[model samples]
Target chain A: MAFIQFLKPKNALEEGGRTAAPIQQDAGEPEKTCPNCHKPIPLSRLWSSYLVCPCGYHFRMNARQRITMIADKGSFLELFAGIVSDNPLQFPGYTEKLETVQNISGEAEAVVCGTAEIGGRKCCLFVMDPGFMMGSMGSAVGEKITALFEYAMQKRLPVVGFTVSGGARMQEGLLSLMQMAKTSAAVKRHSDAGLLYIAVFTDPATGGVTASFAMEADILLAEPGATIGFAGARVIEQTTKKALPKEFQKAEFVLQHGFVDTLAPRSTQKQLLTRLLNAH
Target chain B: MNQIPYAVVKLARDSQRPTGLDYIQNIFADFIELHGDRRYADDPAIVGGLARLQDRYVTVIAMEKGHTAKQRSCRNFGAPHPEGYRKALRLMKQAEKFGRPVICFVDTSGASCGIGAEERGQGQAIAENLMELSTLCVPVISILIGEGGSGGALALAVADRVWMLSNAVYSVISPEGCASILWKDSKKAEEAAACLKLTAGDALRLGIIERILPETELGEKPFYDRIRRALAEELEALEKDPDLVPKRYDRFRRIGQVKERT
Candidate 1:
């Protein structure tokens, strides 16, 4: 009950921050521009708006920020934090990349798994951090996600996952790919128990992650303009030699095509999710 | 191993190529076909069920593209719908529960990308298969008998041991697919084929496949003989391993090694 206090209006959006700042260019990089409209967007406004542009272009959000937006105040108890990748393939420079991403993202792996309450309904929450190697599913991430689903089944609580991944981590090679299988199976077990599983897909959910648990949700919600698909648009276009619809692979497109249940914005996602969970 | 040429791609796609059903019929005994995903109507694209392989009872799952135009349309040209994948998963889980090994034959161009399939959770169905098959307690084997395109093939390819028929090709996407996407020209599929390195030889060298069953070119019997021998040897070795689950896990864990650029 006390966790509801964390849903402060101020924290969700910066106070009049959108019109206050102008765009700034980082050294050695092009000006931060919205890919949709080619309009420059200030970095601060980008972060404050959870990376959604004025043009409705959806930028990726980190796992921590996503959890903050959805979970009740101080209700998240992280599980499987000890799980770390061993770089089983000994793939070149993989260990170094893992170390670098871990240090930068403050996450042991691509996914953060834990238990949290949504609208007073205790549920298992797992969020994929696109900042961490594009939220790729590797051994550790897969293991943690599987653990989260299994744990949810044991507790008889529903599960909610927010996915934003580039796909399976290719560095771990096929082992990384196997996570799609492991995590999917976990979802199956959770579903077999008649527990609800909701997936909130964010910008750029592709590859194996899109193929697995990300698509297996009882209720699939997506942020506006988020990219969700199995193959890259470029690949699809090249293969078919045809111009795809403008909305192809976008969140709204997915919803229109019946792949998603609802198109929920980041700001009101918590309330929407709460209502869904309570009704369930 | 490098890029596969266009001719090789055509060779793999040859209509005379033995389909998954052909292999199942040649190798297994007392095969019984199972139907429906139980959640939806039966999808004719994928055929799977219980079968006796040598002395062991195993679940045999195969993607069937069909032979004639009518048959191909009936089977969706070997492209599986969500129910097809669900049926495969149902059969696979049943095999696991019964302590039977699972053998999958992949020959699909890919999963059906139709609007109906998408609406019914085609991605979820494939994802479920990958997840369930990954850690199943029993031995699991996958053989690429023909085209193994994209996630459709991958849905069935995550096994303890993955083998390829000499003419088979496995890729993240089809050469035509890659060509169209990368070059914006479908005719450049030849160039895309070379870059994809999807042929059995390349797959073996890249560690994507465990082994390749060499083509006899003589006829169906010789080709089947090579597949049977390879499958028997691998299954025997896998069946004997006490740490089968972890060992199977480890086998997949080691694929995709790259040399560090100095």
Candidate 2:
């Protein structure tokens, strides 16, 4: 059996240039554009607001950057760092694609699962990096998430997961889709232990992930304008042949629909999370 | 066995096909119907209860498509509301708590897509079932009796062993829905069905389903008996296996990860 060397911890990050720095290529654009207002804003203003434009459009952030922004300085301890995918299906060009994304995004996997401190409250955190394969969940991603929930259960700690994905990794086929069931089960076991699980949905949280752990939270929160749903807007529109409301899949739309508990701005997420974790 | 996928899809959707209630009545004994998710109204589409499957007492959950027009409205034509999924999850958790095996009869075209259902957290409800069902320590067996569509079917389909009738069809989306979405023509449902690979045979080949029970021409008795025998064998095997949870977990993990190409 040939195993991909990328599965090794150091090898994945070394091949990817820098693991510590998150993907901020979008910030490098001379005039950071806000999708809502269609206005180019300064990079400094975007970063200061945690990538939420002044006009209220939420820009995407990578996993490491998310942790850095939320977790206290030097308080994040990464777990399941080396367990990367092995193209189990051996799908055509899958390994190459994974390598390319890893190198470009500077992340080992789409999701970063570990422990972090939020306002002195210890919690288990899993942040999905949309830069890498749209933060798709596959075997490696599933394994890391399951491991994190198990760890939380054993340690009797609260869990805080930030979901940002385009859905299951299609390249892995059924393996990727099955992660939905796998991760959800882990979340259930953790919940059964009477531990708190809070999930924060960010931009473009759809597909299998949205159906699973992303929605299996004791307290579900979302960024103000994040797109969250089962089927995409275009598919729903085509199937029903009715023009959808402008805010159809947005976080605020879902909140009004009672799917999410609340919608917070990206800037206040850490503060809100700290309070939720401490209270839980 | 050489039939096209669309024919199987059509057969699976045929109203003449024996539904979940029919199989449950024939296969199990001493059935007691359970209801309500405790958090919402009891959804009639999902019928669950405790029953004796031969000697093993198990929790039985079935998606009912109703026989009459009035019954169809009552059962929502087997399209479960969020409450139905919640009810199934509530019962499955009860079975797990009691160490009883779970048997589900999946016969839904899909989850209810109505506005009321969506407002009630339909996606979250289905997702909760999938997540909780995976970790249930007791063995779970799901039999696809008719149309197993999308996450609705998946909520009940995540089991240690997933069996499908020879004519059953399970897909991510209904053929008409898929056709309309992909080609902007619902009339291309046949082409969509052909491409979806939703037949029992295709599901088995794809590793999504465990086995396909052969359809006998001698009517429903023999078919139900064969399913009973298969269930007995699976339950007995799972009873002996001590690593039930991890074994169940690994069963799904190995799916869609083919080592060598055909």
Candidate 3:
């Protein structure tokens, strides 16, 4: 029960009793401008708010930060950290780019997978890193996710994933494309076993990922204002030669279109996920 | 002969090359064209139906890029919309019920990118196809007749056996698309093509495809005949296997396997 203290707060008081803190930014403190409200928010305030602005704008969070936010403290046991991408095709500049991204993102691959407890409920979890090549799915990402699902099926545990990808890693060529089928088949196997799988789409879950595991979940959730679509908006606009509707490809739009089950804002996502897991 | 990757790409996308409908018309007999996704309007880009593969009934689906300009427009240049994928899925499910083998001919630049396609959930459609096709009780054989573009091509290609035409090219993104994104110049497409390893030979080497159908007398009666015979023989062998679904899963499962880089 001691681990319960690390759980996300359900109310203002539980949030370190810091709800009464002034929203106004102090002069000379580092701040970030909110894209939605166009207001400067202090870095400390944003961190305290889970990187969400008071205007309800959800800023992109990296995989590690997300794991910390969603998983119980000390409960995340990482699996498949040794699996890293190799340029099997020997695509020019890909090796250099991967090395640079690995150093900058401090991640071996775009996706991090492991077992963890959410609100005391055990599950297999994967969170895609936006910092790592925009969280592209290549061989390593596919292999790790497939292995995780296979493991979860054997353990009879639910699987939760947060997806944010630019789609398949083009540097890996068709092998990248094949990952979609590989992961989808694994998901099918886990699903056929009657295990639970929930997918949470973060900003920009598009391309091959959108067409594969991102949409194959039993419960599909999206964060507010997340860009979730099969094709890039610019490409669609250029192809159709028409103006996109307001908020096109946003999570809200996807919900209206009946693709996503619900829109879970940052604040309520943990609780909603826990409740869903417990319900099943 | 080892043609340049870009040349293979051009050959695959050549307007004069035989398209999906051509293969269906030439290889199978008693072809009956089915229409519509039943959830929405029918998409001409993908044509699916029942046909006989030399004495046995099979469900045939293809991404038809019409030879003529008018036909191309009608087929949306073989780029399927969400409805097209749904229709293909519907036909596949029908095949499963009747215990007929499914044969798909994939030739698309990619899935259609437009307002309506997204509105109708293109990603969901493709994802559904991938999941369903993996576990489809009946054997599925997908032949890459031309361009196998990304998820669009993959939607119909989760099969027990996937074969590619010798000149066909399959890639995550078109070389031009890849070049524009990576090098910030589409003029680097030739270089990108070489680096992408999208040729049929590269696919065979990677084990992404099981066989490469030679293009000798390509688009001629003999070429079609050869493919027909291959399909019939392969289907006969596949129909005898009890582990079709699991083996299909493992076929894709073993692809991209790499050792842990400790």
Comparing only chain B with the true structure, the TM-scores of all models are 0.93, 0.94, 0.98
In terms of docking quality, how is candidate 3 classified? medium
State which candidate, 1 or 3, has the greater DockQ: 3
Question: Number of backbone collisions per candidate, in order?
Answer: 8, 1, 0
Error of 1 at B177 (Å): 9.7
Identify the CAPRI category of the predicted complex in candidate 1: incorrect
lDDT string for model 2 (A39-117, tens) is 6676667677777667777777778878999999999999988878878645456788788877777787889999999
In the range B1-262, model 2's lDDT, one tens digit per residue, is: 3247678888888877888888889999999999899997999999999999888899999999988889888889998988999999999989989989999999998777654565677778878788777788899999988998767788998899998888888776676765664466988778767766678876788788889888885236777788888898899999888998887777775554322111
Lowest summed lDDT across 10 adjacent residues in model 1 chain A is found at A1-10
lDDT by residue (tens digit), candidate 3, A31-111: 666767777788788899898889898877878889999999999999989999999998887788887777767789989
Give the CA lDDT, 0 to 100, for residue A195 in model 1. Answer: 95
Quality of model 3 by C-alpha lDDT: 0.89
Q: Please identify which of the two predictions, 1 or 3, would achieve the higher TM-score against the true structure.
A: 3
Per-candidate DockQ versus the true complex? Answer: 0.21, 0.26, 0.56
Which ranges in model 2 have alpha carbons more than 4 Å from their true place? A1-29, A86-108, A120-122, A154-157, A241-249, A256-258, B1-16, B29-38, B42-44, B50-52, B55-58, B65-77, B93-100, B135-139, B167-210, B236-262
True contacts kept of each: 0.24, 0.32, 0.76
| Per-residue accuracy of model 1 over A1-280 as CA lDDT, tens digit each | 0000001012222211222232345644323566567777666767777667777766556678888878888999999888788766454556887777767677777788999998788999999876677777767877888889889999999999999776666545445555666677678778878999999998777767889889888999998878777666664565457677777777887787678899988777889989989988
Docking outcome class, model 2: acceptable
